[model samples]
Target: MATQTAAERREDARQRYNAYVATCPSRKLLDTLSDKWVSLALTALAGGPLRYSELARTIAGVSQKMLTQTLRTMERDGLVSRAVTPSVPVRVDYRLTPLGEDLMPLLEAIKRWAEIHMEDVEAAREAYDRCSDSEP
Candidate 1:
């Protein structure tokens, strides 16, 4: 057997990936958006640009550190853009990039689904807890 070149190996891996596969690259993206902070941040940005404090305020219960981390990751992924204005008191803002805007509708659907199913989700959680408590 012959050793495959790096490019050939990459192409083979790419061909093998399907979203349904556990090792698919897309899984990492899904994981990123699965974080509560990341989804909420994207949802908040869907409205328009907002400063750090504004996002923090709009997303209830998100800590400053976590919010900052989420924003950094989104920015790195090209999902959001950060602008820092030079001034005596510098102003920094974040907004969805074109790519992010393109992805927003699907994410919005996920958000809405959660909202529509909140009662069902809560009931399921309660039932699970009750059953677990009864376990030996």
Candidate 2:
């Protein structure tokens, strides 16, 4: 048999992973997706490129520091790209890279699902709290 290429070997290894396992590498990707800021930021950039201030505005309630942190992490993961335009005081823009855009649909769907079920979630939380308080 012919030797497997590096890409093929990596793909084969990835195919063997089960995210349900605690030590699986796929767990890291799940953890990243679990971040609220990441999902919001990705959804905002889903439309197109945006400036730092614009992203902050679009994703209401996100503090500057938090937005910076989120954007940096996204960029680090190859999900977003930051561009600086040297004009006047210098303008910076953030946009979803192709990979980020590819993930937008799923993110948007998840956001919608959360919004639609928020009332049910709140009710569940209240019920859970009542049950816990009564037990202890």
Candidate 3:
């Protein structure tokens, strides 16, 4: 029997975890990425770094509490960095980290696909509802 190198062991561990499995830690990350606020925030931040108020405005219906919570979570997850500048009123800004930048393309593609296919999805929903209604 041969001992696995550190790199090989890390790769093996990564391969062992599947999101479909209930206990896989990756599911937690999927939950975060799938969040509506997170998706919107990521999309908005892709343009550039933004102040907290700017993010709130750009995302429309997100409440202050929710936005704050989401930003904190993103920061903890290493997906974003927050900087606070001391002044009379103070200034705070949020920006994507390198890991977050790597994730943006995937999220952007998902956003684009949803926008492009929304009509089709709506039509499918209507058809489904109509069929469901006629069933009984």
Q: Model 3 compared with the native: what TM-score?
A: 0.91
TM-score leader: 3
Scored against the true structure, residue 120 in model 1 reaches a CA lDDT of 100
Q: Identify the superior model by TM-score, candidate 2 or candidate 3.
A: 3
lDDT for model 2, please. 0.91
Which order, best to worst by TM-score? 3, 2, 1
Tens digits of per-residue lDDT for model 3 on 1-136? Answer: 7999999999988888788889998899999999999999988999989999999999999999999999998999999999999996899999999999999999999999999999999999999999999996
Q: Which residue pairs clash in candidate 2? A: none
- For model 1, the superposed segments whose C-alpha errors exceed 4 Å read 1-16, 20-23
Q: Scored by CA lDDT, what does every candidate get? A: 0.94, 0.91, 0.94
Pairs of residues clashing in candidate 3: none
Off by over 4 Å in 3: 1-10
Distance from true location, Cα of 108 in model 1, Å = 0.9
Clashes of each: 0, 0, 0
* Candidate 1: Cα lDDT at 94: 100
